[model samples]
Target: MNRYQSNPLSLFGMVLWLLSPGIARADGHQVSDPMSLARDLVHRMTFDQKFILLHGDLGVDFHTSKKPSGAIGSSGYVPGIPSLGIPALQETDAGMGVTNPLNGRPGDGAVGLPSTLATSATWNIELSYAGSDMVAREARSKGFNVLLAPSVNLAREPRAGRNFEAYGEDPLLTGTMAGYAISAIQSNGLIATLKHVAYNFQETDRNFYNVMIAEAAGRESDLLAFEIAMGLGKPAVVMCGYNRVGTVWSCQNHDLLTRFLRQELKFDGWVMSDWGAVKAPSDANSGLDQEAGAQLDKSVMFGDGLKSAVRAGVVSQQRLDTMNENIVATMARQGMLEKHSSSGQPAIDIKGDTTIARNVEDEAIVLLKNDGNILPLSAQKRLKILVVGGRADFGVLEGGGSSSITPYGAGIRIKADGEGEMGRRYVDYLPGSPLLELRKALPNAEITYTDGRYPSMAATLAHQADVVLIFATQWMVESFDAPDLSLPEGQDQLISAVGAANRNVVVVLETGGAVKMPWLHDVRGVMEAWYPGSGGGAAISDVISGQVNPSGRLPVSFPRREADAPRTTIPGFDKADGAMFDIPLIEGADVGYKWYYKHHSNCLYPFGYGLSYTIFSYSNMNVTHQHDVTVTFRVRNNGRADGKEVSQVYGLFPANDGKREIRLLGWVKSGLRRGEEKNLSVTIDRRLLANYDTKLGRWVIPEENVMLVIGRYAGEAEIQFPLHLQRAEFSSLDMVKPH
Candidate 1:
């Protein structure tokens, strides 16, 4: 039996394997302390064996050997010492699903969930856990033990290509969602890695730049997000990014890796370097436990070099011992020390998994505009519907790069680096298409489909239909930042021509991040269906056909143009060679809606902004305080249809507090029947009201009157209530426990 199922200790008790160190083994047998066990294992190892364990060992095996009967291609692998009873650890890519190519077996690869941004839009922590659990289960079924996922970095840059992989600008939202995902992944017997640590907010020359920001600025924003996730999830591993923070690379920065993550946040996990991120052997003492993918990239910084450095007293023997102990302890905590293998060709619960994906999309599809109630298109009217552009007949556009997954019947698009393209790309398409699903859902309507190859031709076709549904696509790939927010491949021009040709037009945007909607005023309705996953097609069909009401909200604010961004210009050079420069986070803690509110700027769409098909009224608000602040309110679906409303709460602090800004304290999703009212309570963590006082070396909760705003969106609120906080301060680990 698998230790995960048969072990007697509860999940929380298992954490004592690191702390108590005197607990009995999984079997009914007495064992030495975990530190003694790790030290004993290290004492038996030779220099060569220890050297091999420090870096990656999967390159030769993956390139020249055959994979296991049900395994996918390797992401990272480190061979264990067989004589010492340690088993190898196999890691896989992504948050959505297994992305590596699987062995030839039925259901080898699994379906994907919606993007992190989409799930964040739902503002439901339980749903986030369910989605991440599904992904971890599929990964374990494919013989993987570690999932490099739940990127918690803030979306500080609007043009970042990998925004779909992470939650948005607000630290509370991003950290809360990531905590749920990490807990879900590890709870299913897989190790979850909190990745791209610190400020990996942009992809432009990411590997060739240093991020310069004040310590206080980081403590309030990006760094705070990491602390919140670490406190809640207690992830098994943390993957350091490639960039430098200040003068040292993040993989080897003692202040970030040791002083902040370890000493302050109290994260007990091991730290690993991003692929090819190691730069020096002296990094052994900088809090990095292992170097991954160095062998594949042909990097010679660690390995024999580290061993020699330790032998020469350049890198201390104590440092090497500490690293080895951290790795072994983490493995033991995750039950990876035993013989690990998957049940071949897992018996997939098709219906259950599909429902999970569909429900997430149902909650995440944002309706930006529904002028004159043009949406929920009347299927009973038997009207002519023209579905043009966005390659909807082919597949949904999956987010590009390392996190891309191959669904049951997915297709591939290979675009080489040429002309204006930034890098070589391979994009996978979700199996089912929206056009086909829409046809299946509304069989009574005259539904015509087109690839929209030519703008003029597409416009001509739009004129013949009673209503036009133009699909606009914006493709985002890793290793580069988008040059601008404009839709790629002249998609804006196509939307303009189609909107001009038909007055009753609705636009559906398939994008990784925010894109400029040039024709927003011209269209009757617009939906931001961000990179919805395998079940996206059906979700969209349900929303447009009035089968499911749209409930998703924008996680990040949408600006009218590039200049409206907090930082107009980012540091970059034309050359591909490795050159370094400093990229300063000038706006500091002011990001997304905080920046807009502070500057009084014009925004295309505000954060937490989404239109629902049914109208919902908020009333009878009340606030209570214990260890945390709890807000209760009555929500009634006033419109004639049943729908779900995401109620958000924001804290408005005194204007004199420059270090802090208005924050999303908490949110809840309430599903109501027509004219039905339900009372819901959302808890606001008291820690959010505190600010890190560097001088005092603690989080200080000031005694002041704070106005809590219950809002339909970030900028627009329905009601305001006041609270008085008594002055208090807390140590680093005070709020680490789950609220």
Candidate 2:
């Protein structure tokens, strides 16, 4: 007769609660509390039901139709149990943004967001969060609970095709930014995944390439970022990449999947495979719970192969149960079952969308070089300008593939004067040119443009113009990474030809990432206008016409030549065997600015390098805590231009031998008007000073002297401060957090 006692009637009620479809709604409890419901439902599921959930509902229309199939077949969704009312969980593609199919465009549904490279340049966590929120809204609205995003991969090579979709080369920056983005999406009642589990840097033979990396290098640069995101974001899902290390593929590597990701990193979410990433059936035995983007070849995700493995004692039933438990737990964490019954909200607000896109584009447009102070062009006069290049009239903005976005309306276009003929042939998939937008901004200017491919034609136009703006674009599309860093064949030739005819030339480059600039010396001005999304034309015009000062910095290192790249030793880069190159990663932990700083090699441009219309100075750097420091500086618009300046803070750790070297720790962006000075402060944590020691098998902090550097960018003249650590042994966990 006790209230808490489970007598016959009470036991019957508990059983009824376990099987009731209406229990969640009948209890008047919020559906958002999926964990509680999942715990209850999982206890009642049969072994077969648990196995089906773990392998995912593999159907041809899974991502498209929002349906689940019991078996791994390319057909309509086959219900696991019609009477049980257990709906299947569906996932969608998204490293940059929501990838929905549109008019036969595979994986195109909603208006995608900007690439990771563009977001990284902005260096604004809030912007990334907003973008992810939009992607989540779109994904949910399209009937998908899992939104795969925040691809936290390292940008080790400049020529990597996927570079546009990754944050940057630095582990701290990439992890922090990706973590914020994932958190934002997941917090909105949807699940955001952190992907390419480890060391999937290059796309060349991505499906079968062997990424030979030293354990130290992988831990320091690649794995460090993944661990940061996992600890901070706690993504609902982790997608395994299609790369191999030593002899084990990532999807089939027990050491990586079980020992590292699940146990060491303490990740409790389900691990899914990249499209066709699982090479053999045994891959699932390595702690992978699901096969996402499952193709037609894998006949039964949880059928014959799994049954055979269990019967043969290759994979125990306990392991299968554990995997299923993880999947069910993740589904509960994502509120998949509860949210599945309701409809979703809209993807974006039209007005807010354009404004955010423009702001991000403005922040990401890097001003590389400006001599004679020609930038922020005087808008008072009807300047005679000539806009020429293949991508001038039709803007070459944003990268292609899954990250591509189609804005609500036609983006702002640059306008030009005279008989300028826009390129009729669309060679690539980018949006319109900046010329149309520039023309609209400068209606009074007498502008003329011609296809710069013809030297004589460009010469004739340049001779008659007072200023020439050349749009040099590099389009690196799908299934291939760039061969070299050089500008396209015709672009380099056109720049050289036009520069000879006109000294007042402004080169605007539209590329996914860095490209070698052989003609940098010839042009008077340069702008690294990365594929600037939909409103790129307007952003370019604003920078040129004194409306917006360029504040973007080089997120990745710009090598002076292709040979300067660390991966250049890999031969047959352009051939089919290019994906099979066996070159060693001798550079190891020293990548990007690290390599340049250590070796004292001259680069075309150092990482985080950017030019502003104004000037800023660093001083009064004070170390408050042994593990933390706050630096105060002054940024003055010395130039007679209203613009913004980004103050970069770098930290240098003295080697165990007492030698001094500097590396970037953190940075802040500030805005100021002409002749106005603004005070700025930035803090750096002690953990940013740790280095991975191969012999020690852990991150080590030198007990010797540590130097603090504050500069405009990497390799610049830096203001220095010194400190000493009493103890040197510090784990990555201690370093990421301050005392």
Candidate 3:
């Protein structure tokens, strides 16, 4: 018989091969390729088995767990196929520690790191790494292998409810910080996910709004931030947003996924849809690999319908195989498939984690204004102190949303009778309190407290105290945009009244993002504590009592007025009650400080602006160019105490270049003793000098010469150096280090 001819014995062998899901390659060969391994597994999987991997597993212990809906405790679980030897995947929410999975504190308790905005304000990249590592450890301790964290989304719109979850307004700063966090999380053996892919700036119409942004504009701003993160972090997964990009949902956008992310940016990771985000079976071919949280609510985005679609050739086998390969390949590369089967929770050090959280909070406390130097309250003077408003004794305010972290102690429950969905939730108040900590630090002094319910009463009380600490807060949640930037609930009026009553007034703002400070000039000292974490209380005491020097800088500009921002009126949907409308990103590259630079507008506090207990001066600027360019300067701590300073370097391309403006080229943080000086250098990535040339399909050098400016903040450069630009075109931000 011919070798190609099939007999009874040959037919039996072929059937056996097909039945064995663990068999080798189709050609009876083994290849050492990750993709090949994934493909081999896909070929053996049945349509039903393949469909199961496309959605979450109904294994979350929600009924027994205390976590609220949409919280980490309610996060979905996915079971693996035992026959295929794939272990179950346990996922959790956020970089701010493993969010209270039970919705409330469970056992010995977990740590809550400072909000992402607070961490970013430090302008210290190493802190990002440290914070991520600690959080990842907590995730492992909770028996989770995936961290849905390190949101690289830009704070493009100040009112963006999730602004606290993002890094900052600028792409360079946001990308650099997120990259470190992503790398650190993965380094701890957990998968890190970069989220809310494109133009997810507003929460008002998040689920149905369409972002009609120009492709080129998108690439340079928010997309640029994601690109930097993807190149540096190489995260295992990319979570698409709930809204549409242009006309299609981000989860089902072919251009965004297959064309941009997969082709131009070279992201090889699998794509996962945001909870209840996938809307059609055709989305299977458009880059959505998994539909998350589907089993929780029994949503039927992908199940029997997907299997039928595949069988009928609506979604080709090639597309189905591609999805399976992406998922399996990512799991294999991350070693998730190998070690996920292990049992027992990893070790967690509560005290150690608290220390990390405190350190970040201490460094992130921005001293926006210190008019009379009334801050660093002298321990030698025995004086009366008054702490007003914001439930300082209760807990620090945390941003509301999925990123909200439940601390280690008693969880605060809200009354649901008169509250909205975002308002009626638990607030975890751990071991620290600003009021208690402040009282402990000033034992000899008489400390008084007030709710500040009556402005006149509070103002009268403030006048009697030797010093006043007014704690003002504003809440920002994910489902809606802030009504305005001003301090809500008459806090601004209270602050203004108190400032008028006492010249020694100090305002401690516990907020999610920048707030309009009408009392900025009247107060003696101002602190922007952007949602400091569980240990925020102790950190605040340290800064006020002179135990720690203030080093945090403003990551986003505090525009003098809301109108000073890029867009005064963010366009409304203008559609029917449930219909979708489009909003374009017309700002282009002129975002944040760039907009201020072009408009020459006066901001209340520019990006990178901050004041320390000690003063620093910079001089001796020098520049050198080779394959890369470097700027060196001497930073001297010209004061009586040691402190840290973040030196910012900016670049301005020639007008002849396609885009002409000042950009944050590089930055570095330095700590020095009083009167000590250090020669520090900041390197400018050659990629920073170029813009994405869509037509050329590469980053092109735009100018022959670039001007370098060094200073403590943007628009306030102390020195300038001109440097020559070379290497016209290239790709890959892996070679670039902006910090």
Q: Please name the candidate that would achieve the greatest lDDT relative to the true structure.
A: 1
Enumerate clash totals for all models, in the order shown.
0, 22, 3
TM-scores, all models, native as reference: 0.92, 0.85, 0.90
Question: Residue 572 of model 3: what lDDT?
Answer: 54
Ranking of predictions according to TM-score: 1, 3, 2
Error of 2 at 156 (Å): 1.3
Tens-digit lDDT track for model 1 on 306-350? 877888998987788778877776666665666644555366675
Local lDDT at 409 for model 1: 63
Error of 3 at 250 (Å): 0.8
Q: Per-residue alpha-carbon lDDT of model 2 for 1-739, expressed as tens digits?
A: 2221122112322343242222132224346544455556666776566555645443445344443434222211223333344556655555555543232234333443556777777765556766776666655665556666778888787888778888878876687678767766776656667888777777666666666778866777778888766655667778888777766788888877887677566677778777666666567778787765544335555556676777688878777666666765565554444434443355456456545666777878788889887776775678899998755676555565545554444433232222322121112333545777777777788877786778778877898888999888776443457777878666887888888888899998888788887777778999887777656677788888868877787778888877777767323355474255443566666667777776677888888888877776555566665445566666566777666666677766554334445566666666666777666566654446677776765566666676666776787755776767565665555433210
Candidate 3 pairs with clashing backbones: 67-102, 67-103, 73-101
Q: In candidate 1, which residue pairs clash? A: none
Ranking by lDDT: 1, 3, 2
Local accuracy of candidate 3 as per-residue lDDT tens digits, 1-739: 2111122112322343232212122223323566777888888898778876787743345444333233234366666766886666678886677765444334535688888999999887777778888888888777777788888778778777788888988887888788778777776667788997877888877877888776666777888888767655667788888888878999899988878778666666688877778787778888888888774323566777677788788898888878888888766666555533335555678888889999999999999888878888877778899999988877687776677776777745443222565445444444577988888887777889998999999999987999999999877776767767898889999999999998899999988888888888778899998888878889999999989999998888888788988767544534455567776666666678887877788888898999999988889999987766778888888999988888889987664335558788878787888998888777666666777777876777754777898888988878888887765777643443211
Task: Output the better candidate (1/3) by TM-score.
Answer: 1
Q: Look at candidate 3 and tell me the lDDT of residue 660.
A: 59
How many residue pairs of model 3 clash at the backbone? 3
